[model samples]
Target chain A: MSSGIRVASLDDIPEGEGIAIDKSVTGTADDIALLRDEDGSVWALDDTCTHEDASLADGWVEGGYVECPLHSSKFCLKSGEVQNLPATKNACPHRVEVRDGEVYLFPNEAP
Target chain B: MSSIIEPATGSGAGPSASGGERPVGAATAAPRGALRRPVEMNRNIDVSGLVDAEGGLLDRSVFTDEQVYRQELRRVFAPSWLFLAHTDQFHKPGDFFTTYMGEDPVIVTMDRNRRIRAYLNSCRHRGARVCRADSGATRNFTCTYHGWSFDLEGKLVSVPNKGGYPESFDTKDWGLVEVPHVESYRGLIFGTWNPEPVALREYLGDMAWYMDAMLDHDDEGTVVVGGVHKWVLEGNWKLAAEQFATDWYHVNMSHTSALTVLAPSGKPKAEIVHRTGRQYTDPNGHGAGFPVHPRNRFDAQTVHKWMDYDALRERLGEARVEGPLTNGHATVFPNFSYLPVNGSIRIWHPKGPDRMEVWAWTIVDASMPPEVREAQRLYNLRTFGPSGIFEQDDGENWSECQAIAHGFITNSVPLNYQMGLGSEREDGRHPGTTSELYSDAAGRGFYRHWRELMNTPAWHEENR
Candidate 1:
């Protein structure tokens, strides 16, 4: 039984950018990063970078990946896989659904 | 002198001289009072018998003893002025670089007042590392563990749950531990943990005259081109330091294959090996060995085009500029060393009695053209970087020496350092004691100073 939380609207995050959802709102272990690709697809992953204590919400989003702002480690938005050095572990990805322009985050559930 | 070099009489079983056994259960003890205090160990090991400076003999146990390595961290490194970083690395307020001083992690920062300072990187609360990045600019270093924030000056500015603490809990008492002394000379920043260290220039002594040829060529000075390169080598840190200080004789033998393969400047091996040079040994433990007339081994034509010979001769006297130009290495006492020809400066960070981590940087004059700087960077990488041709050869010898140094039979044998022992003389040209190129005067001087520091517990007791 999966419960969905209405985090934000589809238009809340701009193209090639990301925003953070606090853990208090999603009830997850870490803050969630809501990223919007250039093609208008939405993805959700843990906000904290695996290599260091830095918010991925402040990172730059492009194509299907987000580059960490602290050490520049990149992570795939769709599956939360690490793409480069300085970071080895994959980030935790969460499920997201868009119903009539409203973004619903299935906290702690894999995509 | 005979007593100092006496053969080890003990069976070479466990820790000798100091009868205390190595603590095995200390790590598992419950953390109660003074959690950050280091484990207590026997510091009185009687190091006077380890080095015979004038007789030119050194005991092998200095390279393998755990007690001696710990004492060195306190007596040798704590009071000495150690190089931290170049001034160019800090251009504005909040610029910072992380480095180590005898395994103690330090954060060198440019405060908001534009003054440079150093602090122990461990947080005041729980001793967690406050800054983790290698180099960056930031206004506040916030601890990720519990949200304790410190300003650029290392003052604890904010803490979570301000109302939870008692009214007597003042934030002023919780700032990061600051290094007591910090100074700079010729753009190189140095710091010391001693509350009252001698002035930087005074401690450097006449070694500054020899360094001016490479550091003070232009009015703008020099800047580090590429960021630092760090790697670990399985050897005693002193092996690398002593080699850079006093052992140019090993180059022709150890690096013969490299010299033959690279043939830098297209010069024949005979021409490069036949050049006569001099070795300088300073009373302050600094040492430099360089040829009287050095040929630019890496592209002489390009170097000639970039350097203004007449201007350099006018600024630094012809005697100082001509000798010690290119193709030489010098060490500033303990761990900091540099090679002029390779455009590399490094610190030999000791990991233990048998291992070290090298942090190196390629430095070039700020006045050089972009192409020249790029050439220097590439040349440095090819010659002295971790996987470079010459470094691999040097690392092999050092690691092998360390492996043999720990053996019970080998540890009883004394290493001879008697090459040119009585040949030191005053040339009136250079400031320090000068000897033949292939001499171990500088190596002897290094051990002499090391013995002095090990025997004397306080800086005030030093005869300097």
Candidate 2:
């Protein structure tokens, strides 16, 4: 049996944007960011940027990356890899599943 | 107003040196014992003996000593007026721009009353930065950590959990620390941390008279045209400041390639270098160097067409309009430098003994037409911006100076500033000490003032 928890539905997130799942609800060390690509594919990563105390859900999502609002450090949404300077550490990737239009977060599991 | 932030205890790092303090009630915060200990100020270095302005000699160790750099932050920067931002940057209440006062990050904002105020950017709670963006409009600066927030006047407005704090925890006692002295001359705003400082006009001295050529030429004043260009350079801050103040002589050789590219098709090097020019050195340490006559096609085509020479001459007198007001380079004491010809105004923000970060902007008369302003902006970007041709030429020389100055034997040798010693004269036409354009009088004046500040412990003593 999968230990995934339902977080949100597919229609809840706008295109090229993200929504944050609170740590209390996900039971993880950090908040999880649920991002929707322009093509409607959903990805999950740690919400806090590895470089600073910023919520990636509040960043600008374009293409396959999210740009940190604080310092403009871009990170790959799918793999959680940092793509710029001022941020050398990569954000942790989180597993996500979409079953019948409902979004399920796999707690701390890797994508 | 009550001062909320106490003076840093012991030898705690300045605002720019230290990261955010440990978060309250967090187990992940660094262990108390692991925190940095105060560094003992170096007593062995004789600050007074480092610069012999009369002899035109400067010790190289001044550029390499960590202790000297630390002391300079307190003595030179804390009391001196440093450029913060321009009035044009703030359009409405709560509009702000972030800048540095010698390495210490600060926020310059317009309060609800439209009064300009500046405060240290560090948060009052756990010391995280309150404002991270370069420029923005906001109602309250909410810290990313712990959700502490401050209003436009830097007043502590809210806390995360009101029930968790004891009754003794008062928000009024934890407001952001204000810079204390904020003033403006023309459109440029300047701030100082010292509670008591000389009046801005008195501190500007003769430099104000010289600056009027550019600042007061038009009735509408000036405004920064574009986004700031910033980059780090591996060089001591003084190297850039002093050069802008009094080293126009370097242009003939250091920027030969730039000259070759910029010079008109048939113009000879002799015509550029042999032109008569003047230099001015003020007791306040400000300096300027400019040609007596227009020397380039750019000035003739762009500057002359836009500037009202007749009105400026009538208003400012012929001595200013014809001389120091023309195309030139100048520095306002320690780090604020500008080039009137290129329309570039910059601050050489000291990062460390061996490094400096340059923040540059293009400024133009507000009354100028859009086309003239755009032309000046492009010209400034091509000549003095981060990737400008002349900037690259100058950066190489400055960085190399820092790279070699750290060598044991290299630092022991003193450098020369004796280009035009004793040649400084009081020309009846201009205020302050004047000399032929090639002199290093301004360099000597700069060191003399620097040494004075480094030796004096308090503003009252220095002024006395």
Candidate 3:
């Protein structure tokens, strides 16, 4: 239940979709992308599609899903579940928390 | 017996060989309908009794014969319940998807009544295909050829000139030849050729039990997340159908290269996974499964401990998925491979004896988180795509096996399946059919059933 290490300050970017690369998953400079939905909330998931290695960060966001550009398959950002076809699996999600004026992601892969 | 069956079967008797004379490579003892005999032997093949306790394996002719391919369209594919797109394809009323039942193009749609319907694509007028796209939603169809139109119910609602036909013309009979039966089990839709094929539920039998592990669990259970990747291949339709249905033996050799790459550069021995699968050939031409298992994985205690049915509160309401995922695959009669991989159902419909189109789709647990879905997709693509290590290797072998038949002598020769020939034992009370997972019984059983389907002139009586 420890708070995530501070990785970025609040004024660095607004809502919608944002990127921060300094987050470390076991010491690797894991580049994570923050997707802000219409509600101004944010969720972080692995930035790549498992099928063809397509970039998931730039994908179209709708109804809490990020769709891969190559095949148009959608994945749930929160749980990393692939909700659509062409893809049969899920993506990876991370822990994100806001403290003071900074946002940090605790990278974990237990799911 | 060996020398008499050879003949020029590559083209299955063209104009020259078609004159009803002895065909090239044809055995002297071969009767008019007999062209399946192999031509040579020695480290290759020995043609003798291609037809066995199960049935007959095709000579090179089955692959190249146009007449044979046409006959199969009716005898094998037509009468069999060909798998079509799942119910997910028809998202709502008026939604539709087209698939081939052998050579016959089919149209499956969700009507206004919310019921699913299927029909031949041919127009009621000149027999031209009525629907042209892969899939769509529409209230009615207007044939571009002669302006013949029909509604979602498949009833001919209009014709450009009503009087174009004679007074005796009956529109009811002309309605798109509605597939007599369309049934969906756990979101998978299938159509049959006979006025009645065995109750699909019954045909499915214990397969449903296995399928439940892959599909039919949880809410929103499975959805068509994307479309199919179709490709043409040169091989008997049965090869593809049988490969998925129950051909686990090929993995040892056909996939040797890919498996080598996936594993730590090795060391001499092949220890990828020790397998034990058996084969069970039914009375009709159906029933094939890997019968292969990565030995000793599904333990009784494990099922009791992990997936306790007391949990069947969700989807099977938690009772299922509690069991370990064992067994490789369970293929239904004619077509449809209910696979254990990526939780997908593959329908390898026959185009001709030697040509086919592959349609694959993924089924995921609806309640699963998106991250899990994404991971599964990645694994599925790496393993099953056209270029996937597994599928790519399979494609090469299936085609090469077909290509080897072109040689006059090689084409007529027979391949040995004599392994475990006399050691096979049949058990009656297993609740399921069983064969040696490590032997050639699967292939032998497959060929046996193929012969029965091909030779049987009558559907109800014992196959000839």
Candidates in order, TM-scores: namely 0.74, 0.74, 0.63
**Error at B273, model 1, angstroms:** 1.0
Q: Which regions in candidate 1 have their CA more than 4 angstroms from the true location?
A: A1-111, B1-42, B264-267, B294-301, B459-464
Report the lDDT tens digits of candidate 1 across residue range B252-275: 889888788777565556757886
Candidate 3: residue B335 Cα off by (Å): 2.7
Span of 10 residues, lowest total lDDT, candidate 3 chain B: B1-10
The DockQ scores of all candidates, in the order shown, are: 0.04, 0.04, 0.01
Deviation in angstroms for B76 in model 1? Answer: 0.7
Any idea what lDDT model 2 has? Answer: 0.79
Residue A17 Cα positional deviation in candidate 1, in Å, after optimal superposition: 18
For lDDT, candidate 2 versus 3, the one ahead is: 2
Can you write out model 2's per-residue Cα lDDT over B259-305, one digit (the tens) per residue?
88877773446867776678999887889987776323235357567
Candidate 1: residue pairs that collide: none
What CAPRI-style quality would you assign to candidate 3?
Answer: incorrect
* Model 3 vs. true fold: TM: 0.63
Better-scoring candidate (TM-score), 1 or 3? 1
